[model samples]
Target chain A: MADEAHGEGGGLSFHPMDQFEVKPLFGGYDVHWYTITNVTLWLALAILAIIGLMVLTTSKRATVPGRGQSIAELMYGFVYKMVEDVTGKDGIKYFPYIMTLFMFILCANFLGLIPMSFTTTSHIAVTAILGFGVFIAVTVLGFVKNGASFLGLFWVSSAPLPLRPVLAIIEIISYFVRPVSHSIRLAGNMMAGHAVLKVFAGFAQVAAIAPVAIIGVMAIYGLEVLVSAIQAYVFTILTCVYLKDALHPHH
Target chain B: MADNTNAAAEVAAGTQAGMPQLNVGTFDNQIFWLLVTLVVIYFVLSRVALPRIAAILAERQGTITNDIAAAEDLKAKAEAAEAAYDKALADARAEAQRIAGETKAAIQADLDVAIEKADAEIAAKAAESEKAIADIRAGAQDAVKEVAKDAAKDIVALMGGKADAKSITAAVTARMKG
Candidate 1:
C-alpha cells in the first residue's frame, strides 16, 4: 500500500496509515490467532528489552549503579513512586504488576520510534486489552474489596439530594468511559505521531519541499519521542488512578 | 483464518484497507500476542526484574542510612577529641602558672631571710665600733688630766714658791670642778 502511494503518483502521495499494517513475519497472509506476525516479533523484542534493562543490567545489583543499571533503577523508582503516589501506600502491593505495564509500554513506545519499526502500542486492540484489563481488574477489585459499595464510586454523596441521581448518572457514564479514554489516548497518540511522521516522510519525496519535509520529520520525530514517553506515563498513571478508585471508592 | 476473510479481501484490494488498526483480521493476532506479551512481561517483572530492582533500591537506602550514621559518629568523636585537647591545654597552662608562682615565693622567702641576717650583723659591728671609740676617748681624757697636774706643779716651782702636794691636788680639783 505504501508502494502504491508512492508509485501511483509522480505527484505527492501520502499513505501514512500503511505503516500500521500487521504482516506475518514468515510471509503468510493468513493472520490466525496464533500467527507469528510482526506484533509477535515486536512484542518479543519488547520482552527482551525488558529483560535486558531490568534483569541483565541489575544482575550485579550494585548499590552504586552503573549506566544500564542506573536506567533500570531509575525506571523502577519512577514507576514505583507513581504507583505509590497515585494509588497510595496500599498500592505498593501491586508495584510489580504496575512495573510490568510501565516497562512494557515504555520499551514498546521507544522501540516504535526506530525507523520502520512496528509500533505495537499504536493498535487499539493492543491498548484496549491493557486499558480494559485495568478496568476489569479495578472493577473486580473494587467489588471484591468494597462489595456493593463499589457502586458508591458513581454516587456523589456530597451533592444535593435532588441532584444526587443526576450526578450518579453522569458519574456512571464517566466511569464507563474511563477504559475507552484510557486506551484510545495512548493508541491515538502513538498512531497520530507515527502517521504524521509517515506523512512528512512522504512529503520528502517531493524535491522542492524535501528539505522542509525532512526538517518537519525531524521536528515531529522529536515530538513523537516526547509523546511516546508521555503516553506511556499517562497510561500507567491512569492505571494507578483507576486502581486508586478501586481501592478506595468512597471519594 | 476464515474470520479474517473480509480483511484479507480488503488487503487484497490493496488500497482501501483504511486504518490498519481497524482491520478486524489482525485484531486476534494483535490481542493474542499482546496478551502473551503482557503475560511474559508480567512474569519477568514480578519474578525477576522488579524484585531485583527493589532489593537494589532498599540496599542502597540501607547503605546511605548507615553511612550517614557513621559520619555523624565520626563527627562526634572528632568534637570530643578537640574538647579533650582543649581541656589538657588549659590544665597544662594552670600547672605552669602554679609552678612559676611557687618558685617566685620560695626565692622571695630566701631573700627576706638573707636581708634580715645582714641587718643584724651590721648592727653588731656598729655597736663594737662605738665601744672602741668610747674607750679611746676615756684614755685620752685621763692622759690630759695627768698633764695638767704636772704642768701646774712645774709652774709653782718656777715661781720660787713650793706648793704642797695635797694643796695642789685640792687646787686642781677645784679648778676642774669650776
Candidate 2:
C-alpha cells in the first residue's frame, strides 16, 4: 500500500502515512460503527495478549514467581509503586485503573511493532478516550473529594490578588488543554515513529540506497521499541500526577 | 507512457481515500472497542490479576514477618539460656567457695583445740617439776642438820669431856628444828 500510494511513474516512491490508515478487515470501504476493521482486530489481539500475560500466566500465584508470573508481578509492582509514590498511600485504591491503562497502551503499542502490525496507540480516537477518561475521572474525583472547593485548583492564592483572575483564566485553559496535549503527545510520538520506519522501509526499494535504508530502518526500529515502552510509562505517570492533583489539590 | 499515466491516475485514486485515520466513521468503531477492551481489562486487573499479585506480596511479607518474629523468639530463648547458665555457674562457684571456707574453718578449729590441750599438759608437767625441786631442797637441809649434831658429839668425846646422849640428842634436835 505504501508503494502503491507513493509510486507514480516507473520510479521508486513511498507514502509513509499510508501505514496509519485504518481499513476494514473485510472487503468494504465503509467502516460502520459495528464494522470489524483492522483496528478492531488489533484491539482484540491486545486484549487477548493482556489476558494471556496477566491473568492466565499469573493464576498460579506462586510466592516465588516463574518467568511469566514475574513479568506480571513486576508490571503490577511498577504501576502500584508509581501511583503510591506520585499520589501517596491514599492513591493505592486507584491502582487498578492506572495499571489497566498502562497495560492496555503498553500492550497495544508493543503489538503494533510487529512487521505488519497496526499501531493502535497512534490513533487519536484511542488515545483521546484514554486522555479524556483521565480528565473526567480526576475532575469528578476532585469535586467529590474536595466539594466545591475543588475550584481552588484554579485559584492561586499565593499570587497577588489583582492578578488572581488572570491566573485563574490561564489555569482553566491549561486544565482543559491537558487531555488534548496528553492524547496528542502519545498519538503523535507513536505515529511519527512508525511513519519514519515506513519511509525508511520504502527507501529500501531503491537499488543504490538499499543498504543505507535498511540500516536506517533497523536503527529507527530499535528506537521505536524504546519509545513505545516509554510513552506508556509517561502516560501512566501523568495519569498518576493528575490523580495526585485531584487527591491533594492544595499542593 | 500510457501505462504510466494510468498508474498515476490509480495513485490519485488511492490518495482520495484521504487518511483513513481521520475518517470520522471509524471513530465509533475504535471508541467502542476501546471502551469494551478497557472495561474488560479493568475488571481483569482489579478482580483477577491485581488481587493475585497483591496476595503474593502480602504472603511474602507475612512470611518474612513471621520469620523475623520466630528469629527474635529464638534469640530471646538463647539469651535466657545464657543467663541461666551464667547464674548456675556463679552459684556453683559460690557453693565451692563456701565449701572451701567451711573446710578451712573446721581445720583451724581442730588445730586450736589440739594446741589448747598441749598447752594444758605442758603447764601441768611444769608445776609437778617445781614441787619435786622444793621437796628435794627440804630433805637435803634436814639431812645436813642431822650430820652436824653427830659430828659435834664425836668431837666432844675425843676431847675427853663427859657427853650425855639424851642432852646431845635434845640439843641437836632443837637446832635442826630451828
Candidate 3:
C-alpha cells in the first residue's frame, strides 16, 4: 500500500504551471488558455450576475422604492459611502473602479469557497497581474494629473537637500516594489491558507483518529473562509490607497 | 492478471524515476498570471464602469437641487399668504374699533339732546301754571267788590223814606245785631 501511495504521489507531482495547458484552436490560428481563461470566464459571469440584479431591481424606479430596489439602492449607497469616506468628492470619479474591485474580489473569493470550484486567486501569477496593472494605471494617472511635479513625490523637498537623494532613492525603490509586495501579499495568503487546508484534508483522509481529523478539517475550513474575505478587503484597500497617491502625489 | 501486475510495476517504476526530480520553481509563472488578472480588473474599472457611476451621481445631485428650489418657492408663497392674512386681520380690527367709537359718540350726543329738551319743557309748564293762578285770583277779587256794592244798596232801600241819618244808622245796627 505504501509503495502504491508513493507511486501515485510521484505520478501526480508536476510543475504548478503544468495544471494550466494551452491548446491550439481554430486550426492553430488561435490558442485557448486554461487558468487565465477560467478566471476571465468567472469574472465575466460575476459581472453579468451583478448587472442582471441591478437591472431587475431598477426597472421600476419607484418613488417609494420596493424591496428589490431598496436592496440595490442600499448596495449602491454603501459603495458610494465607502468611496466618499476614503477618497472624498474627488474620489467620486473612481467610484466604479473601487466598487468593481470590491465586488469582483468578493465574488471570486466566495466562489472559490464553493465545493469543487477553481480559485483563480490561489495562483500567485493571477495576483501579480492584478497588482501590476493597478501599479501601471496609478503611475500613469499621477503623471497625467500632476505632470512633472509627480517626480517630486520621491524627493519630498521637506527633507534637507543632502538627505533628499537618499530618501528619493529609497522612495523610488519602494514605489517600484509596490506591485511585487501587493501581489505577493494576496497570493501568498491565499496559497498558504489553501495549501494548509489541502494538507489537513489529506491528513483527514489518511489519519487513523477520526475525531482529531474532523476537528482539524473543520477548524481550517472556518479559518479559510475568514482569510479569504480578509485578503479581498486588503487587496481592495491597497488599491484605493494607491489611487489616492496617484491623485494627490504629494502625501 | 500477470500482465496487469507488470504494467502496474512499470508505472510504479516510472513514478519512482520522477520523484527525485521535483522542481519547485513556479513562482515566476504565478506572478506573471497575477499581473495579468490585475491589469484586466483595472482596465474594466477605469474604462467602462466609472463613467456610468459619475453620470448617475451628477443626475441625482441635479434632482436634489431642483427639489430644494421647489420647496423654497413654496415656502416663500406660504410666507406671503401669512403676511396678507395678518394684514387683513389688523385692518379688520382697526375698522371695528372705528365703528365702535362712532356709534358710542352718536349715542352720547343723542342722550345729551334728549336731556336738554326735557329740562326746557318742565320749566315752561311751571311758568304757565303760575299765570293761570294769578288770573283766577283777580277775577275773584272783582266779584267780591260787586257783591259788596249790591248789599249796600239793598240795606239803604230797606230803611224808611225820610228817616234821618241817625235813625237809619240805629236801624242798620239793630239788623246787624239780629
Best by lDDT: 1
Native contacts retained, all candidates in order: 0.80, 0.72, 0.12
Show the colliding residue pairs in model 1: none
- Shift in Å, residue B160, candidate 1: 41
Interface RMSD, model 2, angstroms: 3.8
Please say which candidate is ahead in TM-score: 1 or 3.
1
lDDT by residue (A1-251, candidate 1, tens digit) is 54456557667767688678888889757788898988999999999999998899999988889999999888988988899889999999998888888888999999999998999999999999999999999999999999999999989998889999999999999999999999999999999999999988988998899999999999999999999999889889989999999999998
Model 2 chain A poorest ten-residue lDDT run: A1-10
lDDT of each: 0.88, 0.87, 0.63
**Highest DockQ, which number?**
1
Stretches > 4 Å off in candidate 2: A1-10, B1-16, B82-178
Candidate 3, residue B150: lDDT: 51
lDDT by residue (A1-251, candidate 3, tens digit) is: 23343346643321222222221222221222333344455545555555554445655555556786666666567677776766668878877766766766666676666654556676655666678878998899999999999888897788888999999999999999999999888767766665565555555555476568678878977988998878877887788778878887785
Best TM-score goes to which candidate? 1
lDDT tens digits by residue: candidate 2, B76-114? 999999999999999999999999999999999998999
Candidate 2, residues A1-251, lDDT tens digits: the string is 44465546257566676667767788656667777888888988998999999998888877778999989888988998999999999999999999999999999999999989888999999999999999999999999999988898899999999999999999999999999999999999999899889888888998899999999999999999999999999999999999998998873
For all candidates, state DockQ relative to the true structure: 0.37, 0.30, 0.06
In candidate 2, which residue pairs clash? none
Those runs of model 3 whose alpha carbons end farther than 4 Å from true positions after fitting are A1-41, A53-99, A140-152, A160-166, A192-230, A244-251, B1-53, B110-178
